[model samples]
Target: MKLCILCAKQRAVLKRPKTGQQICQACFYHVFETEIHHTIVDAKLFRRGERVAIGASGGKDSTVLAHVMKQLNEQYDYGLDLFLLSVDEGITGYRDDSLETVKRNQQQYELPLKIVSYGDLYGWTMDDIVREVGLKNNCTYCGVFRRQALDRGAVMLGVDHIVTGHNADDIAETVLMNIFRGDIARLGRCTEIVTQGESSIRRSKPFKYTYEKEIVMYAYFKKLDYFSTECIYSPNAYRGYARTFLKDLESVRPSAIVDIIHSGEAFEIKSTVKMPSQKTCERCGYMSSNDTCKACVLLEGLNRGLPQLGIGKESRVRKQIAESEQKELPTVVQHFSQIQRDADAPDIIQPRDPSTVYTPPPRMPTGVLDPPTKKTLDW
Candidate 1:
């Protein structure tokens, strides 16, 4: 029975599943963000007078997220200095176009925007990582480095928490991915809105229940601008398959994605599963189960041209790390050997956080790179 705020056209959007008071779709978009702002305030997601940053990519999800958060700040009088935080991945056509969108976003929203480039953060772009690691699992490198770089950027900006544009579809895909991988520990903690930080800056996903399609629709109807380019080296065949599966399933069941999110929330893991110990990585100071993080290990491997440090279990990758320091084994061999070790170490393997599902990106025929993909293209 709620009326549209725009043309006074009343609609049936009153059944929006209780996101802290539902309104029409137009109003819901506005109210949903206000709800998130209140949730952040009530949950103390940010300090009363702290600086906050939006992980702006100039994409629809991010652009909508940034705009809503800005409106909420003004309406609710949230006492936080907000800005846009972007990563320039240096993929030629992909990221350059995205960065252009971010620039436009800065002017449109009147928010201070900051860009942290991979060339500046790690001295290697996605192009460089692909050239070295190839298509098999280079995503792991992009994921790890981009995460660390975001924190490093936030640290430079002196912000407490970084908000991403991740919505229900992304979260659902991650949950499925973790479930498929049997990462139970991650599954248990994936829906955590606020990731408590010990070393790395805190992070949160405010739009956890928002749908990607809805976000796109909202942005389109609202005429909010965003970047729409795909990454050049997105070759995750497995994830792509999963995404297709999800899309097909969604066609059959309209609420399949949200249902999956609920399943992730409802399912419980056995108490006997031992979770990864909370420890700090000595090298990078991020949360880790062992002495160093995967990022630290991979960086060490890259510096030595030993791919082994980038993959495998703690003990196994540790051994590879040690071997790289001493012997001259092919790092790729050492890397797969760690996988065998990982296969054997079932005790350490836990279920991934269910809220995080993996969606395979659309497949690209491997040939030559046309437009350089930017570093921040992945979900």
Candidate 2:
């Protein structure tokens, strides 16, 4: 039996993928958690008393991340008010099942949970999307909607920052995918540990340097409840090819994942190569490189019964919209700023007199703003 390298007492349980160290379960837990703590501290991922949301999906990576984050915060006195934020894509057999696990985690972790469904936000669901645009390019709609859904959920929760479970392996796969597609702009920032959108709400990866295998190991040893099933519609994803190649490379060379991330970080775009500038979407006020955000465009395509409007080339899509008989397309019901204002407003409290009747104010008319009942506070 191999003795533990860190303690030299207990038997070694497993070999770490990031470092080829044979260590006991206790040491593995220590090093695995300590490294994440170091990453957070070194990157300044959080500030004292900041409300941070864990982008929980109930998958192994996200489950382990929530558990570790809560553990670290309590053990190290990070002074963070943590919450669980989930996006319900409305996949019947997939997301629906996983979300139950998230609910259980909410109870187990004693953290407030908020779920923002696609149907509620966009008047469509993954089921609705798949039914409209069959299997091909359906992931595009799901990806775009889910990204904005998370952002919208964060806004609703009024969190200062959001942390996702994207680990080194996921980042490595993204780096390779960007390189394969020659997306220079995305390749430039895909490996960043932190990112912020137009709303200035920060998004980060606390497990940016962690390994998938170690994450699984940590979850297993800790007996965490997580859903491990893959989305049924992901068989045809473009990223699968890059993931396969990356896994094959890792089998031969364990450090390939970290190396690819390092390479992505080291890449420098030339001054001559033009990068797309960020702009607000005219339809929904979300950040976009074009006039309309991808979510708004895709939603319009679905609503117009022309699901192919946002699928292909930009020129062709624009031409299709131009040739269409409809003079005006539907815009999002509310802008992002309005959503933020609603989220920041405090809940109305009941009057102090119990016997006295309390009549609530009539609902405001459409397109009209309500009078503030209390002093307005800025986020």
- Say which candidate scores most in lDDT: 2
The sequence of per-residue lDDT tens digits that candidate 1 reaches over residues 1-379 is 4444444664524323222232356665665565667666766676657678899887888888898888877787777788788888777767766667777678788777777788876667888777777887777887787877677667656677788998887878877888898888878777667786543467888787776655665665577777655576675745666677877876567588878888888878778878778886765566677776777678667767875566756778767756654553232211211211112111211223423423223222221112334222112
- The lDDT for every candidate, in the order shown, is 0.67, 0.83
TM-score of each: 0.76, 0.89
- Worst-scoring 10-residue span by lDDT in model 2: 361-370
Q: Which residue segments of model 1 deviate by more than 4 Å?
A: 1-44, 198-200, 325-379
Quality of model 1 by C-alpha lDDT: 0.67
TM-score of 1: 0.76
